[model samples]
Target: MDLTSNRQSWAVVGGGILGMTLALRLREQGKEVTLIEAARDIGGLASAWKIGNSVWDRYYHVTLMSDLHVRNILNDLELEDDMRWVETKTGFYTKGRLLSMSNSIEFLRFPPLNLVEKVRLGATIFYASKLKDWKKLESIGVCEWLTKLSGRSVFEKIWKPLLRAKLGENYQHASAAFIWSIIARMYAARRSGLKKEMFGYLPGGYRRFLQAFEKRLVDAGVTIQKGTCVQHVKRTGSVVKMDTADGFEREFDHIVFTTPAPAVSKACPGLQPREHGLLNGIRYQGIICPSLLLKKPLAGYYVTNITDDVPFTAVIDMTALIKPEEVNGNYLVYLPKYVDATDEAAFSRSDDDLKAEFWPALKRIHPHLTDDDLITFQVARARNVLALSTLNYSESLPPVHTSIPGVHVVNSAMICNGTLNVNETIQLAENAAVDFLKLDSRVAADVAGSRCAQAV
Candidate 1:
């Protein structure tokens, strides 16, 4: 396929990581690329917001060392110094008090699971980590798989709540293969030091990541057009017919969609099969994450899980986690709630109304956090921010390539296996680029995904 036009242009829709990374990779190969985004900014859902002088994410974001793709990017961007590895805390709340939930030894001590249940659970994880092709496991439900393999107690105590939070009512039907991939993440991130389980974040927010990629894009000669919405598209033979929201019609030799799956299907309906229900079969709950700047740190731990709470499954006081001092004693909290598909009103709620409702619900978790303790608040809503990976979800996700050759799709909805964190985002972006470049043979290797395993 000849990607060269008279102007030698290639249009990349979506300015997020997948879009930016692919654009830069293509331009580095000496292709003229134009990047378009509807938002005023470039980071997509991955962008950061500022509260006074402190920068925080719309939702709490962190990466594991097992993220081979992210490791490679950080080194290439030379952001090693700008990064920090913190061994954070993970806990479960039952009837209120937080339990120390970290590592294998502590996992066994977890009151929620008995010694026998814990032993079986541990063995299951070890077995999963060594797995090569979990494709066959997709046939069974996750709940069924765990109950049969581990037992009823372990599945009820551990797997059920997590699946409920992650997949809503469809947990019972979730694929065993998908559940295994999720379990392997824990096995990969363990360590024995102060934090055998550690995470990476730039001293600042993810804006640093955006900046690094933007710099690389500029250096590679990619044209980045911000606040530009793509109004329409028409594919004519090898070249795609295009029309912008700004009322301009143009053409490109190739187009790669890094936008959300919903938007892509909406924009180019003809290219996708009506039966490919990977994303469409799944339903995503919108997030109403409100962050508050506080006068003090709410908790000592950087990360905490609120499995039992009102209006929210978890409340991440990012200020406390990243160190409140970094934000000048002002704490930032995230109040994220899952919403329905038809509930447009939830997404359109005002910030003030959100704060009024969010604060009291927050007080349920921390009673001492009075109204006076609240500093400032910001409400962020990313509609379809998380794809509902319900039971039997693995079969829904499609391969990188589609019937349309020059077109590619990548996003959070496409996290078919493993944790869909930033590290996975980077790896997915790199892998997509290889597909776009038709370089699959170059990176294929037999690496098991154990402890950040990257098997080709």
Candidate 2:
């Protein structure tokens, strides 16, 4: 095979937004791109599925006004102009009651904290937003940092429970940067030219956006292999070989593995020991988010943060952002619980078992919601969702370029700074593509030059 062609063949081994975007970018660079996904579709975390009669995202995702990368892609797909932006309210479930903490008045009256505690809590958020030194925050544990800023009362009464809800017992291992990133994004939402926290979404959720995106990719001359799993990867001379589970092999000039770190480690056995250790060292927080198709809305707030004991961390009322008419006039709610990725028992629990525990807790929060009000229930579990921002997380992250020539690993584990959302995911892919492609091109040029010199 000639290694001097201007057009290089690239394989993106993951159909998530990361891989899709990478393939599109590479194709735009005049490279022949092939996207392979193990799932039936290519959206990965942003993928949509049918729940009852409605087709919606497998996990709950909302677009923030600050999400520039996401908006850019939507613009390319001609869906940005059609985005529906809404000012949604926030709720806090605490002290056995649901309270509206969306505004100043509601927040002042919140019963979970007294005036002093509320002031301290507010100060903590304000302080965190103004702090720009995120790397320094990584040195301190989340508990110590929050308690220092908010005091013991505010930390115990509010922050601790919220931390446990999101991070589970893993909160103890997290750094103050974890909380800072969350606060920074929430603050950015209000600062994103809207001057208020405005969440936007397409009319048909991700289904419409993805269909358009898929068409755009296909039109751009990118090959998509859906339901095809890459079992192993090896480097052979100037080309990278990918072996599928079906015993199919394909060689590409370069290949990028956008799958999870563990998956990458298993697929490519030739990685250096240090690189393998770094990849395996990264910890991820999994989510078991269940979508509830309800007859009526459960609290009008888009997001209801919980400080009380509940089976789920938060209640995301999709109907708040999306009109009820969208899903057949039925409300859609997402109850997500972030668990340790290694917790097999939690992931292995049957749907019926979860229903038994989840519904009763939800009823406790809203007694009016009963079995009759429930239209249908569906669970979406991902063992690796967001990479946990541990102490000095970025310092240990494996580089996108692996030890093997022309084989790179780029996944959610590389997203160390921001929350794992569509925007951050897109940004990571765009940035990684630039760096990796430059290196890839240089390597190809070197190989071509050496071959020409040898022949001469």
RMSD values for the candidates in order, in angstroms, are: 7.6, 2.6
* lDDT for each residue of candidate 2 in 232-301, tens digit (9 for 90 to 100): 8999988999999877789998889999998898888899999889888888889998888999778788
Question: What's model 1's TM-score?
Answer: 0.85
Q: For every model shown, what is its TM-score relative to the native structure? A: 0.85, 0.95
**Per-residue lDDT value at 397 in model 2:** 87
Q: Positional deviation of 434 in candidate 1, in angstroms?
A: 2.1
Displacement of the residue 48 alpha carbon in candidate 2, Å: 0.8
Encode model 1's per-residue lDDT on 173-205: one tens digit a residue.
557866777767866776744335677777667
Residue 257's C-alpha lDDT in candidate 2?
91
Q: Which candidate should be chosen as best, given TM-score against the real structure?
A: 2
lDDT of 2: 0.88
Name the candidate that leads on lDDT.
Answer: 2
Worst lDDT window (10 residues) for model 1? 440-449
Q: Which stretches of candidate 1 lie over 4 Å from their true place?
A: 1-8, 193-195, 272-279, 339-349, 390-405, 439-456
Model 2 misplacement above 4 A: 1-5, 191-196, 444-456
